[model samples]
Target: MKIPYRGVNAINSREIDKVLILSGTFGEGHQQVANAIHEATQLSLPDVESVVFDFMALGYSYLYPLSQYVYMKGIKKFPRLYGYFFQKTRKVNSFSIKLNAVLSPGMGRTLKLIQEVQPSVVVSTFPFAAGVMSKLKQYGLINIPTVTIITDYTDHSYWIHPLTDQYIVGSNMVRQALNHQGIDDSKISDTGIPIRPKFFQAHDKIELINKFGLDPDLPTILVMGGGYGIIRDGLTTFRALNALPQSIQLIIVCGHNEKLRHQVTEEFKHSKHRIYLTGYIDYIHELMAISDIMITKPGGITTSEAMAMELPMLLYNPLPGQEQDNAQFLVHAGVAMLAENLTDLKTKLLHLLFDPKLLKKMKENTRLFSKKRSTFDALDVIVQMKRQVSIPNFSVTG
Candidate 1:
């Protein structure tokens, strides 16, 4: 499965070249990151064709549904167990190695796809895809340059591989953590999380507010529960928000969760404050523009988008894994506040609502923390690897 450099050059010199991006549907974050990179390549380098595949679904079509069901349900139904495994596998341990082995399957199918696509390089936004690519490179089955884009602000053993030529991360903290895990500093770049280009663009808040039928003068709060509406104590959190005295505009996006949308609609139908409820929508960037503060779970993509838009965040009830890690980084960077319970959420919301100066400071902090050009930066790295050759295997255990 060796692709000659001359062949790569010939392909690159053509009207269109290919960069295969491997992603998964376990959550929205990975797929979002993949789409962001795809969109970037389309906008920045028109000649480079970006193809995104749900590698897990492709490799295990029959079992993917069940696995996805378990993953989503496990996090909500047994968060402590999920967090325990996450902590246990944060490092390159025997357990993690066994788990990676079990997770990396259907290399034959993967190699076949690579041969057919003949991509100049392979990019992985999913950790399991990284594992499969690493194994393919390790066993001398493929020689193309492979890059792993870690979608979270935290470091984990599953995202690291011995043969990956490059690693793109969301923050310096994650880069340092990977460096500590024995990855060479030169192999890693902290380019922030890849998000849609719209997030980086400026929007007229007043115009957007009018477009959405929201009052321009009122303080706007955007509440989101990620793609699946996994917010813990959702009813209680809404009750807390309802207690706020100020006349504010609340936009609640219950992504793809019709039941949650109905529940919220029924609960807030008679509230004094202006309340707007909806299911999944494509105009989140516009919503973010009109928002003064965002109250949501600290998923990697969501928090990154908030920073890009300079919308201060009040992160609520993060699950005890990478989300908790994301919340810590955001709070330390002065861009977000973490709320552990309903009472804390209400208190923090009250403080943020009344304290304009604090909100201003948080907005200022975003410029210092956000990588607004993350997609383009990641593309820069990927484009440079067009000439990358086979990387020799090295010890990952430190």
Candidate 2:
């Protein structure tokens, strides 16, 4: 049996009010941002339809798996090499431009898909998709307005495309970085990272705790070990939390990692704190609502969700690329604290718990820092771009 993709068949209208969102499957952040934009469009503009497609699947059918394997393995086994390449190609220069040209793939398939979709505007949550769109526009193949949403806080040359009409970024820091990279400031909007509307909604903490059958009086700490269970030394972190002198409630979300889930379950069976173990849950907003603090990897979408929920975060062991950049930005913004190791994790967690004033300050900072209207802002950009498309037909100008 074949399954339908998300937001693909949301509308059956033949009208021109449609957004073609191109994303990738290399990481969950890109796809999640696409879905968030799709969700917001559906909720806000009933007439405008947003269709999300995994550009890798649509374009590079056979090479997708191999590329994913290489990327995941390289990040896990050879992170230094990955980070080396990341840093080397971070700035737009002669070599970085050539590197981007080589990395930009699926141009033929991208143009074909755009023609079939006939969208009013094209939005890319993935960098390569934006690259493809920009190349097509440069060649005069497609005349639609294109917007690229940078999913992470860091700026890199990979996401920069000359012919791209606009940029929707996560923060002012990234906007400034892009401007310094020679991108026009007028083309960029600091809209924050798009997340689902549910994250921005007010959830009752006591009611959520009752619904989850967790203790209401005890302070709740939500620990998220990423989508692939990639929190560094996760077992050690769990042990440190279990060893805390304060009696608290632990909500462990070991996403899509049965091995990690089983191991954590076995180890924490007789722990002092009340432990609730789950895997790949859909109710993360609910969990965030009930928690006083969250110990998580600082992925773009997750951190945005935490900030939207106004929850203080203990960012643990971020990988040495955009994740590290995100951690630094959050730490500087006063929304999160970074922990480099097991000791640092325990110490920071204790400080947040012991000092209620600090915790409250972090939560308040989140309120000031979070862009709760990010989804709508992105939707507004898409709508404006759709309205701005004036050219009737696009042709290759050789």
Candidate 3:
């Protein structure tokens, strides 16, 4: 199944022109990174035609929704259980090996997609996709250059595979962790997590504040859940913050969770301070621009966006696995703080909001830490890999 070339003249002239981005939807981070990379490739490398495929939807259509439900239920109701499983599989073990083996049957559809796309380079933003691509390459079924973008701040054995040609990591710490896991230093590039270009662009703070109907003089706190608005105890957190002595403004962006949005609106309708509630907004960059600090869960893409905005984060009740790791990294970096419960959240938020100097220092740390052009940097790595590699005719087998 050879895919016919359907790109521009410049693309047709080059040996490498198409990019296949494989992503999954267990969390929004994977899909967001896939979209960021696709946008970046289109903007910077005009000749490259990037295609994003939802690997789970394509490969396991029957189980995708069920798997998502289980994942969400686990995170929301059984975080400790999720954490236990996460820790158990943190290192390569028999359980992890068996899990990968069980998932291998689904890779047939992925292999078929590869046959149809005929891409010059394959990139995976999801661990499952990476594992499948690694297995395919290991079996000599695919000869395309394969890159895995680690979307989290930590390293896990599930992300490490034998046949991946390169790795794009979020930070030096993640790269170091990967090194300790035996991945070659040269294969890992600390390009940061890829974020949309809009986040990289400068916007006027006052202008954005005015645009959002926010008072420029008042210190604003931005609250967020990931794309699904799965912030644990979000209403309680808000209630506690509203009880604070300071006259602060709050802007909560509840992403695609109408129930959460309605609950928050009803809960804060008569609050003393100015509270802005919105659902699934596309202008997070604008909201981040006007806020003094963020109270949110520490998902990789969201945290990366906050860091890029140089907005100090109060990681409120991060979940057990990657979110916990992200919180630890940010706290250690001094650009963020962690609040495990309601009492701690109130205490930390008050101290940080009242102390202007501390906020400035955190902002400076964020400025030093952010990788503003990581999207472009990741694209550059892909283009370079494409230029250096020669596509080979390979055979597929079960």
Candidate 4:
């Protein structure tokens, strides 16, 4: 009835009917990955019922909202301070260890949830969830084969744990980074970060253009600033784009930011260049399909979705920590370019808009680099791991 801590316990594949996905809403990427995994499981393994639990909400009920607020404000107002702490905690240090220990008050609730759910396998999309699960395994309270899907392009010490059976990473670079941290090559799989299946589907560009009332003749620039519409100096960026000599249309999606939407609409109402501004909508994939270039921050999920659609990116003013790292990888990979300031952003956008050849090359690179079926690939790995629990001690590594 119970599984051992260090060895594989024989579990019937048919009994793995439930999957518990632990996620956090600190940022959109973690929750998005969790949703992708849940959708993938439903589609590929119809027999399996997948459930996602918000780790922060369940564990830190009273403080979750305040913590999220602090995180957003910290990153937006003092990115350098946040970046300093992020980099400082990149590797295991005394501070991080103590911090994890301090966070142990929530582990009891997490364990209670696991016992109630009685899941056959556990998957973690949040680093803190992974830590809690590892601690549970360490204490012999649970023996589920835990998988940690790292959503970012880089690896951090916070995601590492002795009891995590497998790690699904976004790229080989992250895998190598983990390997350098003493993680065995066998325990890591370089399955690109999981994305929603809808992102992988093809859309008719002409149909989308007509449906959205976009100009099919002029190049369309799709601008986004994550779910909260936190584009830095958004009005200035709009002004710069409007001043460009090239005649182009703009589609700006100010997600859930009513003030931003109103401000942009009022500011650009009488502009000569055609501009369309809207609030949050679910049809981002279609918008991406009809656009030539995307001007946005380099959040992992958004960047991955754009790559899947073969849309070249113009990364503008990325946040200092993971966003910066994501932008660097994308630029070096030739799938994207970065603009650190307003002047640089304007110059880069104009150049990229004029250079069709460069745009085509970037699109080609994105096509080559994208793993559209990453969600399914990750699902397959989880399924295979569930089936391989035939011996007392089995490794979930390839």
Candidate 5:
């Protein structure tokens, strides 16, 4: 008698197992990074089955409205309250253990995904997911290598849990910051974060422009409000871009901001040059493929993607938290430039566009900062680590 053959993942003995990826929607960076790693790992390690998870979508999905009310109201609207909680938590004795105790109940449903996946290696791009996995370990549910990727350049108190196995950080500075939080150097690697595979491929700009129906010769500037459409002074920025020479085309991506999207379209309907307006688009890789410059709010994932595209950044009105730090790093590293206010932003943009030498240098610097094989390197590490795991002599489960 012959048994049925498994499709792709079949093994004879304890083969390295699957990867369970936990992510969240607090920001696009978390989910984007998680999915990129998952995709990369899936391709690089064929034996490894990777499942991407949205932790907040578990029980919090039921209480999503209330959860959003608290998160948005606490962090975005009235951040002082959130800061108070953050500060108080930082001072707590054994904050990780205490936090695990308090949040474990709510995180029970998240562990259910892990139970279902039964992964040998679990990776999380969201900070809170690390806490949830840590809690699950205490409940004797997880025993695999649990890794966390810090999506931001700066480390936060929320990412300081001691139970986390390894950290794929964006910079050496972030690794040092983790050390300050008592995390060992052995647990951290400066991976510069992860971006989707599409960003790494080179495309002919002229061809891309022609394909998008944009003028091949025009100098293009891409403006983005992140993946959530919060471009604080974005309207004014586009208005300024509209005043530029007809040789310049401004591309505005108002992610999920329908009102802003419609408003920008109406404002630029009869424009002399061209304005590429979009709402919650997934083709940012293509947009970055053709643009000469980017005007954005300095989110880490966006910056990394821009770096991958070799696009120079012109940061505008970054937020007060990690975004501000990200802007500083970009400016300091020579990968991008910054503008203190709207007037300065307009002037800088015009100056940068007119100066070809400066633009070329910025692009070169960004390409250098962006790791050429970032996704592959991250995947290589996961595969090598999994091979070292001593599981019951078993094989991949189809």
Candidate 6:
């Protein structure tokens, strides 16, 4: 079936303008990146219908949890080992590439979805989708614009692909990393990962407080370890903040981790200060707006969002690999501080609260690091590529 660029396809097919978003639940950043782009795409073009789906959950029900476990547990216990695996296999043999192309859930699912939705383009946020897209483009399964959004600072073999029409990088370092892998500079765009455009706007603390029914007078500290809660000393962090003698409120967003959310809620119920704990929330942008300081892990999306909001990050001991590299970049740029563990986490919070000058400096540094226009810059590049690739086909129709 010939997929036309305009007419009934572009108009009626737009009802399913479904760009397949391939991501897994291993870490929060991938899904967050997918959702950020998904939301931006929908909000920017309301007529365009977008659907986001998990790649792993589509196949091998039991293997999905195992994949998540190896990623999260491997990072915490043996990060270097996990990093070594991807590093060593990035340029694996043709046999592995073909096998990956055949097995990748995105690769297998995308071909059939194309026949049904007839997408004008395919955008992927996960690295697992890269190899398959490259393979399909090589075989000419379907020629739609295929782009990959690198969600981390470091580049592994999983992201390298000659068939990738565009590689969206998080930083110059990542572009350099890809270039080192022999990809032409022309193919890489330093368009930071897509973030919700709302983050680019000014956040009003007073307005957010009123919206969330928060006490305006109480100084607020937001503790978010990660999407899946970490075993950080949440109670200790809260206690140290409570010792300040000033009225303080804490909001803990425990994403998808019900046990951790319950434990934190119980601890807060017995505490003297006002504290709020939620399992999952859709409007973290609002939470970040009202939060004075964010105590959390330095995942790429979280760091990017914090930068967008100009909020200071008090990073706890983040797991190794990409997150560690992400933490280092923020600390080196003077936008955040990294705590060694629970004790240091408490001390770091106390220092920030007491030193007003220090907090102001961090905020200023964050503004310098923030890239407010990355969304459009990235979209512009890929859309241009899609137009370039689709032109010859459209010329015949014209």
- Clashing pairs for model 6 are 90-157
- Top candidate by lDDT: 1
For each candidate, what is the lDDT?
A: 0.86, 0.86, 0.85, 0.83, 0.74, 0.71
Write model 6 residue lDDT over 134-216, tens digit each, in one string. 76777767666778888877776677777888888888888988888888998899987677777887777787788777888
Q: What would the per-residue lDDT of candidate 3 be over residues 313-374, giving only the tens digit for each residue?
A: 99988888898999999999999999979999989999998899999999999988899989
Off by over 4 Å in 3: 1-16, 103-105, 394-398
Model 6 residue 395 distance off true place after TM-score fit, in angstroms: 20
Please give the TM-score that candidate 2 achieves against the real structure: 0.94
Clashing pairs in 5: 13-393, 13-394, 13-395, 14-393, 14-394, 15-394
Superior by TM-score: candidate 4 or candidate 6: 4
User: For model 2, how does the per-residue alpha-carbon lDDT over 1-398 read when each residue is reduced to its tens digit?
Assistant: 01135433344445757788998878678988998988888788998878889887866778889988787667867767777888888987888888777767788877766666678889999998999998898788888999999999999889998999999999999999999999999999999999888898887877888888999889899999677767777577788888989899999998877888999998998988888889987789999999999998889989999999999999988888898899999999999999888888888888998999999999999999899899999889888888887653445556
Q: Root-mean-square deviation of each candidate, in angstroms?
A: 5.4, 2.4, 3.8, 5.9, 5.8, 5.5
In terms of TM-score, how similar is model 4 to the real structure?
0.92
Stretches off by above 4 angstroms in model 2 are 1-13, 392-398
Please, what are the lDDT tens digits per residue for candidate 1 over residues 1-398? 01111222233332467888999878889988988998888898977788788888878879989999899889988989989999999999999999888888878878767766677789999998999998887787777889999998999999999999999999999999999999999999888889989899988887877788988888899999898887888677787788788889899999877877888888888898998788887788999988999999999999999999999999999998999999999999999999878888888998998899999999999999999789999999998886565332222322
lDDT of 5: 0.74
Q: Which ten residues in a row have the lowest lDDT in candidate 1?
A: 1-10
Q: List candidate 4 segments past 4 Å from native.
A: 1-16, 103-105, 388-398
Spell out the clash pairs found in candidate 3: none
Per-residue C-alpha lDDT of model 5 across residues 194-271, encoded as one tens digit per residue: 878888887887777888889877888899978777776656767777777646787889987788788888778888
Clashes of each: 0, 0, 0, 2, 6, 1
Give the distance in Å from residue 333's predicted Cα in candidate 2 to where it truly belongs: 0.8
Q: Which whole-number lDDT from 0 to 100 does residue 339 have in model 4?
A: 93
| C-alpha positional error of residue 215 in candidate 1 after TM-score superposition, expressed in Å | 1.1
Candidate 2 vs candidate 6: which has greater lDDT? 2
Estimate the TM-score of every prediction: 0.93, 0.94, 0.94, 0.92, 0.87, 0.83
